[model samples]
Target: MLSIEPLNQADIPVTASLHRDNLRLGLFPKLGRHFLGLYQQSFASSPYGIALVARDEGTVVGALFGTTSNAEHYRWVTRNFGSKLALAGCSAMLTRPQVALDFACTRAGRYAKGIARHVGLTPSGSSGPKAASRPVSVLSHIVTDVNARRRGVGRRLIQGFASHATLLGIHRALLVTEEGGLGTPFFERLGCRLVGQHKSQDGATLREYRLIFDEEGAYEDRDGGRVAYTVVRAYPKRLGPASTRPQRP
Candidate 1:
């Protein structure tokens, strides 16, 4: 039987190793470790972090991690893990210069604008547009052991995260994945709607999927347990095409 629960400190290393081995990003030996360090700081040890792990007979089989507030969580990660990230950045620049350049270029616009806002050149609310005020949560990472696939592990892990967010009074959750990658279809099958699309630093197309919680409708007396939720489908004004929109139960 597969069971989901809060990720323990002892399991973090295994989770990081899975991330590196399963989702290679063309980094060197030590760089991968540093990358995992960033994930660890953001999702495992950070006070604002929320993470879940799936186990089968005491063996770790899958994991998911995210934050309730992107803005606050990012600030905390940068402040606490800044040095480690800097070292990793420097190493990547020296070793994989092109990759580093591409990443920097891709994120430059957003960071530059953010910096400008911080310096009072552009006030936070001065912008004419802003994301919806709904408390948006992020599922930054989700990985399942290869042997554990096709056994509802991924779905249950996601369900566990959703339950956590729901209990915390968050009503929306989102995640970014490569558009044509394996995760896209999986998320779609799990009832997450594609809300946005963009290109990644490596030029790969990325799609954003959102799962909205129906607080009242998600519960009921069903088989002596709560009702399984079916999220509502809604298109964000910023995104195009409703063809790939998610379905409501």
Candidate 2:
């Protein structure tokens, strides 16, 4: 039987491995498995973070990491694991010089702010975007093992994450994935709407999607647990002209 639940500390290593193996397009994956482990640990440790895993008979088959407040989660990670993560990052960069260049071109400034936030060099309010009165959580990463693909593992993990987010008073969840990537259709199939598109630090075009939860209805998983929201609407806006409009799943 497959089960979706909060990720335990003991499972961090496996979750990190899954991330490294399946989510290779991201910068964190290139930082190596140790860095990925710490990254997952930050989510597992943060109060505002959501870390979950899908297990089949006690073996981890999929994982999801997200944050209710990105600013708070980053602050917590910087305060608690700053030095260690920095050391690991530096070590990785030293061994892989191209990684260093990629970081400089993409994430250097944001990371600098994180460091400044940790040392009180910057005001708390300036860490990132100011928090809204209502919560809007971010779905940062979700991946399933190769053997688990097409078996509903990814869907279960998403439902589990959304259920947890709703319990925290979040009415909507946001995520960004590579344009036309494998994840786009999957998210669209689950009723996420493509809200916008932007270029990443590395100049790759990324698409942002939002999943709005209807508080009145719910979805039940195979295990009979209620997923707090059901996707009921369709994508009404088009990203381009009718000739180029993406098809719905």
Error of 1 at 245 (Å): 24
Q: Please report, in order, the local distance difference test score of every candidate based on alpha carbons.
A: 0.67, 0.77
* C-alpha positional error of residue 20 in candidate 2 after TM-score superposition, expressed in Å: 1.1
- Where in model 2 is the C-alpha error above 4 Å? 117-120, 123-131, 216-249
TM-score of each: 0.73, 0.81
Model 2 TM: 0.81
CA lDDT for candidate 1 = 0.67
What shift in Å separates residue 6 of candidate 2 from its native position after superposition? 1.6
- The clash numbers for all candidates, in the given order, read 0, 0
Per-residue accuracy of model 2 over 201-222 as CA lDDT, tens digit each: 7777899987655432223233
lDDT at residue 47 of model 2 (Cα atoms): 93
Listing every candidate in turn, what is its Cα RMSD in Å to the true structure after a full C-alpha superposition? Answer: 8.9, 9.4
Q: On residues 57-76, what C-alpha lDDT tens digit does candidate 1 reach at each position?
A: 99998888888876556656
